[model samples]
Target: MKNWKRRESFLPVAVLLLLVSLIASACGSGANTNTAGGAEAANGSPSAAAGSSTSGADGKKEEKTEKTKVIWWHSMGGELGKAADQLVADFNASQDGIEVEAVYQGTYDESLNKMKASMDSKSGPSLIQVYEIGSRFMIDSGAITPVQDFIDQEGYDVSQLEENIASYYTFDGKQYSMPFNTSNPILYYNKDLFKAAGLDPDKAPATYGEVKQAAQTLAAKGTPASFAIYGWFMEQFFANQGAEYVNNGNGRSAPADASLVNGDAGIQTLEWWKEMVDSKAAINLGRKTDDTKKAFLAGQISMTLDSTASLRGIVDGAAGKFEVGTAFLPKPDGAEGGVVVGGASLWILNNKPEAEQKAAWEFIKFLAQPETQAKWHISTGYFPITKQAYDEQIVKENLDKYPQFQTAIDQLHASKPSQATQGAVMGVFPEARQIVEGAIEEVLGGSKPVKQALDAAAEAITGKISNYNKTVNVK
Candidate 1:
């Protein structure tokens, strides 16, 4: 075990050495300067090329010794990508001391895998936007400098940030990363369909029982509800019932050795979900939320669950067809728990120089500012991490224009701090989520009962956690 851990720890350096040799050999003939969507240095104009010197006013190349360069790897795509790029451009234009290059690196999973390969190498990013589930791995990999270090050194004020949003990125009484785009799951229902089914159009279903009742009524009227079989939803459901996902305070107090996924909450949720699907009240749309969103927009489904970040697209897509109503993620009857924040946060990598890391922190601070956060919220439909952002004129105007978004804000504010809402931390979270998803499919496909499926998934996840702990040398 010690030998294996030693090899695993040394793998990044070995890979880096091989890469350097390959690059040197290639440079002997020619070098490829184009940057693909991976973690290589940002390739483009001189100013955007990370660490490249800029020309002085005298038309002479200057060393740019006083300036710091930061390369940011991100996973945003499409309109969200555009918004992220605009933020980088704004940041670069705001100051001459720091040159930041933002690179879109596909999905979160792909970006994380690429980062794992690039860590401890020159090809790695100075800063990266990692999804919430990757937080445990980021900390365990020892590849990131916790933002708390900078916050403590610089006496940065964090009270202005949303407490619940910030709490997700906080672990062990320290802020590991700066909260950026944050969101929670919300239930989106078609008001028109509810009215057609003789249900209240103004009031959305607030609990699992209510959702099931609504689904039944809507299905009777030829409108079905579709909740995508998302593993995130499964996690949220556990939290919504005030249940921990793993042992030891959901891995916050100590390293988790077992998954609590087969608890009463998990069984209740699966049973409720299975009952709905079994009765044809709800449709199983497989694992893609996009597919469920399409069905909702096309009026084939009346209700769906998705991240609040999808508000803009769904609202605009259903603009003329139907009225969209948003509510808190449904919970079991009398359950007091709330949704855990979704979305990603900005992390400063340790592979970079202290100056570069500081430069990345500066950018993260700028993003946390009220003005920048308000713009980000408006552009991407992501909730701003800063509480002061709500006071921004643009944010106020936006909320007034799209009142549906207020439901998300209200839900966030209503949530009280708890282990469940703070979210679970585990080194093998990505793999565990996949395992849970597979178990859901097993239950829905009648291959296994709900409790049996959950038990199997818990066993699989525990094995993964054990392997991860062993790899990380966690006792």
Candidate 2:
């Protein structure tokens, strides 16, 4: 009986051991199969391997590709500069391939000088914003790549842009730059000052005679009146009187070596300025546009003629201090010549690699889009470069909120190319402006008669032009 019991116990123990071994073998085989399956899933296909490599060790997918850095040199400063920086940041965050770095190079003149110096050292930024006056210099230097070819290669629709804006950048049927922030002179007035001077706050001067009369009225009321008298402001006044400053719309056609600063239009324009100065109704504070703007904003000047781009500054500076009103720059009595467009464009530098050039072109196109243009225009008070941007519902809503924004746009539509005022392209224009400003100072200071001052200016400009032509080899 004891032997039988021992046999039963041993049989039970043997059965239990067999069951444990079977479970271990099954678990090991299943784990080996899973390991093989995982390896096959990852490496069985090229696309699968690529997908797996893009994930982190923790298995999270990467969000963005490496970005390409792009440098943009611009002249926009203050609030406009901040807005431009924000735009760059937004673009960088929205894309994986491009990262734009915006650097302010001071005023247009300063920016041009810096660009020239940088180009000499072959260390210039990949992109630059150059004023219209410097367009010829950029083209002549052969340092800039024609943007038209890139636009074509990228298949961007250039047809949507206004011809006038586009024409500003075109030389010899090729585009050298892309129109960016374009604006013109406009009449900015203080409504409270107008009312205090016994003039209708809503009634802006529509003609040069009206402007003079308004100035006299304002001065009679002991309200100061001033206007910024830059070369372009004087040029616009002459253009309004149907004067051409140069032949062939300032070389838009044939290459011309001379300037017509002594022409009838130029003389008459100077005479009008002389009358304003002699009457003492207009204050010539200084030649600087910013100084005049400051005077206007301080409520010392009832009105000032300056760039439409200055609208934002005036508004922000005068916030809760005065009501500002803007109007089209007045024309001469019964004369109706259109104004010219002013401001700058973006010029892409040559010598970049094809990929970098393509990336730059992409950025330029991105800036030209209606949404982007509208944002830029509203933020900077610059007129939108694209028609669709101006007509968009959002832009309209914003315009309704600030009607003054329409002043520049309306003036731009009335613009036509004129030789005297389309814009000066002389190599010595900077020097010529200093000479002209000196003559203006002489007239305003009562040191010289208007005609004498202008005659001297004309002689000086003629000599300067001749010298520039000799140096530039202009035929």
Candidate 3:
């Protein structure tokens, strides 16, 4: 009986041992399968991987490069911002191995301020879009890598770009940034109002003197002209008259230490503008271009001076109400000068990795393509930086649809390259502009004479420039 019990125990133990061996064998098989999957992944052909590899007809795996991500900080807002975002989306969808994130920080002033604060950290942008006036500050900041480096490396032909537009961003024979949105001030007038005032409907005024006459006629007919007392208009007037805004080649040849705001050209511009307001030929519409644009569209004003960037919006707003007309920025009669380029450019920052900056350059190149520029020009009223964009079919169609746009392109093309037209560059330009606007208000309110207001503005700007030079350690 004892022998039988031992035999039973032995049989149970043997069964248990067999079950453990089967489990071990199954686990080993699974281990081998997992190891094979890992090896396949290492060899760049893992089945679970997507977009990183694909099989060819030759049964070999083709590996894809990982995307180099970049961030673009821009100041574009409203409808323009939307258009910029769409371009980024299209770029991402059209390519692999590069992804861009565009973040709209704020307006030009606010965006620049934020960029300054973020310079010490890794939180800043790989690429930044800075306004024209900020060029001096950007160059002095030493936080940027000149796009010229990439241009030289790739032998990129920049002759295709608009010379006047590129000139604003060029310094010392190097293009510091890529011109994106470009514009110049232009005269926007209501053609229906012009006819009502007995002025030539198709013949817009092309000089300060002619504009004054038209304003008088329009005012007598119960629609006074309105020009926003914007400092940029002041700057444009100086350029249009072939007058420098500062000494030392309009702050291009060297750092400027004084202001030419009290020069003859400045006095002439201010006198004519103040006379129009005083004689009731033109109405003072404060400093916001938006307010003046609204007044013009509402038929309260017969004419206005605004950026060409406002062209599309102005035209669309006046649709079915009145015919809109555009003319080159008016200068003193017989002044042999042209308008300076307004708007902004794209700069690659040094805060990011070299790979990221190269990636940013790639994106900038994409933006500079004729098709992209054409779309941008059509969507926004800003000029296409590249001349080739004008050759695009959409651009041709757009010109046919909105003939007013032709004036901007014509104005840009007609401009002769000069130091004045290349625009004044000062580190304190935004502040200087504010002072100029304040002086304009003082003169318009009859609290100060034109000469006195402008002299005071010049003094103030000079002081600001001195302080800026000190901060930048520029002797």
Candidate 3, pairs of clashing residues? none
Clashing pairs in 2: 245-420
TM-score on alpha carbons, each prediction: 0.89, 0.82, 0.87
Task: Give the candidates in order of lDDT, highest first.
Answer: 1, 3, 2
Candidate 3 wrongly placed segments (more than 4 Å): 1-64
Report lDDT per candidate.
0.82, 0.68, 0.81
Going through the candidates in order, what is the number of backbone clashes in each? Answer: 0, 1, 0
Give lDDT tens digits, candidate 2, residues 261-283.
Answer: 66776666666666776787788
lDDT of 3: 0.81
lDDT of 3 by residue, 203-270 (tens): 99998899999999999988999988788889989988899999989988888889999999999999
Off by over 4 Å in 1: 1-45, 48-66
lDDT of 3 at 397: 97
Candidate 1, 1-475: lDDT as tens digits: 1122222132355543432232222111100110112333333223544455878889898764455778888877666777888898889889898988888776666576678677655588999988888787777666788899999998999999899989998876899999887888899999999999999999999988999999999999988899887788999998888899999888988888899999999999999999999999999988878789999999999999988888988999999899999999999888988889888899988768789999999999999999999999999899999899999999999988899999999999988789998999887776677778888889888899999999999998898788667656676
